[model samples]
Target chain A: MDMATMNKLMECATFANCYPRDVVFRQGDPATHFYSVLSGYVRLFRQNSEGREADIRVCGPGDSFADELIFGGDTYEYHAQAADKAMLARYDINRVRNAAQADDGMLARAIAGSLAGQLQETMDCIANDRLNTAVQRVALYLLEQAEGQESPASFRLAFQKSLLAGKLGLAPEALSRAFATLKGLGVHVHGRIIEIEDMDALRAL
Target chain B: MDMATMNKLMECATFANCYPRDVVFRQGDPATHFYSVLSGYVRLFRQNSEGREADIRVCGPGDSFADELIFGGDTYEYHAQAADKAMLARYDINRVRNAAQADDGMLARAIAGSLAGQLQETMDCIANDRLNTAVQRVALYLLEQAEGQESPASFRLAFQKSLLAGKLGLAPEALSRAFATLKGLGVHVHGRIIEIEDMDALRAL
Candidate 1:
């Protein structure tokens, strides 16, 4: 987004604080506003009728959630909750729509870009889940998380292992086994922090 | 899309014909145009590095493809091929962009809606692949295809069983097993045609 659009959006922004595990919104709730995380983490998920939950995407600092709800649907399709205590900026959908319609639709193009990028990522996720084995899926995910970091990089996982397993469509035991198998690829897991000793070998998986 | 917008798009459209099994565009090709199916069918698929192909979506008459490529990326992420002999209308990306920028961005909102709907469908597909069993996925797909039909609905499958299996992320044998199981739910399959004798019973699966 351009500075002018950001300024306009910020002018209509309302600040909210959420505690860890607080529900930000539930599936089927009215999609009245768009949210941007200022700190901490948030997870978006969907539950089936059988009560099985699938993690969709997790948002971190500077990331936005539920923006797709602004266009096609009247309600949110997934539930969102704070993974940790966080500050967020909420902008009314109407205000954002109006701003997008203004200034020759520069903001609209930006929104389109965001949605396209999201669609690409989701398609990639679907392909990964369909094409890769559990171990390969875990390796691909580590490579994804390690993006933009230097070789021999180390970073803390944004969510718990169970949540990651759900996101990757793997059972907890399968996830554990996958992590153990990654030891052969030079990946070390020390609690939440992961150190990648050989990024090229990991990617070759 | 409104009549005026449709007229604008049509004015910029060029007609093209394709034979069955002909590729319209390959993955990673320049996304220079958007396509609307004028007749017949087109299948969009992705081929992994291992030469395994996964069907992503199939577009029929009046349906559009590659709208997600209109923003964020300059290349198509999936390959488009004619599932049958087909006629298509193609619109130049630059012309469409110009038109969207004109007329107070009414066209922009329509494009946004299209992108949002595509995102929702893809996400639903991902969720279905992740959360549903092979049998459940086949049942759900039958329900989806039978939507808007009468209770004792019978419709011809749009594609072959093998294609359907690929689209549902199931192996051909698994799909056959799913079909056998669905027979218990009053679903009868004859070649490419499916007859759902009891809608509620099928849904109850």
Candidate 2:
């Protein structure tokens, strides 16, 4: 977490351009590298038997992905796609391995923190799916979005509505109904942007 | 891993004896340590609102559990319980952290390998749930059990049939039908021990 080690980690990963909607990696592909999103939104998802894409998670600016390969893994279990015009930094697996060898707590922390974050997010997704109703899921997700955006009352959704529904494990119709429920509870939505009237009430829901 | 490092790791972890059905840790308990199965079986599960328990995973000899806390999480997200009379080795998180601070490649590899193995197992679970048919789930799971037990043709089931069903995310009835399907494909089952007559056919399913 010191300044020199932080600078070194930043230097090790170089920015690369990505077209909007480009596929970074697809499910079942070989997982060869780890990626950090310097700018833009990235959607991570998997396909179901019905051929519907289930959005597992999304990474916006500063978030990392493809951590399963960091130690050593051959196949990618999820699909990662660019959600918008993006700048991403890719790190070679060997570089990371070598960095870990150099006795850097910051790098180790970064790797551990990245995996931990993904695990937490995944557990949260599964828990919310099990513990809350459709309305609560929507309310909780909205509050999370507000937190992620660093704006408690207003923020824009990074992905499409259908993708959001998939991320929440809800059918599109259920998502629409949840939106109606939010409206009944005084939360406002316009296209992909949501304006939360009372963050406390949303969290309580 | 070298013998010396393995010995050191084993030395740092404390050992304990446990009875069948003993609670290793509850769902909301603080996750200050990780456990390695020294002997017998351990079952990890999550309970639903209806008090129905869904088995998330099972660990037998040489298997480890509770790596989620390594990433900065506060509490365990699942319950870990002894599936049978067991011996377990518990490792303190702080000890491992201090070991990593010493920049030991062996220790780093140990931690990385452990984390990677958990991630691999998780991916397999998701893939089995996603890519396999109901019959295939049972077949694949049986095959894995066969490999783990070193007896594909005949091995005793360590836990009840219902518990296995929960781990596979199938209803007991569905798991019964799956067993029947395996039998139809020439797999033999008596109580818990299963014998596979055709590994290729099982894999093909």
Query: Which candidate gets the maximum DockQ versus the true structure?
Result: 1
TM-score of model 2 (CA atoms): 0.81
- Among all windows of ten consecutive residues in candidate 2 chain B, which has the lowest summed lDDT? B123-132
lDDT of each residue in A1-205, candidate 1, tens digit only = 7898678778879999999899999988988988989998888888887778777777789778788876757888888898888899988987787777665666777777777777777877777787789998988888888999888989998878877887788889999999999998889999999999989988777
Q: In the order shown, what is each candidate's alpha-carbon RMSD?
A: 2.3, 4.1
For each candidate in the order shown, give its overall lDDT on alpha carbons: 0.83, 0.74
Report how closely model 2 matches the true complex, as a DockQ value.
0.30
The deviation in Å at residue B17 for candidate 2 is 1.5
TM-score of each: 0.92, 0.81
**Interface RMSD of every candidate?**
1.7, 3.4
**Tens digits of per-residue lDDT for model 1, B88-170:** 99988878877776765667777777777777877888878877889889989899999998889999998788778877888
In angstroms, how far off is A167's CA in candidate 2? Answer: 2.1
* Per-residue lDDT of model 2, residues B24-116, tens digit only: 999889878889998988988777656666667788898887765654667888888998899999988767666656645566566666666
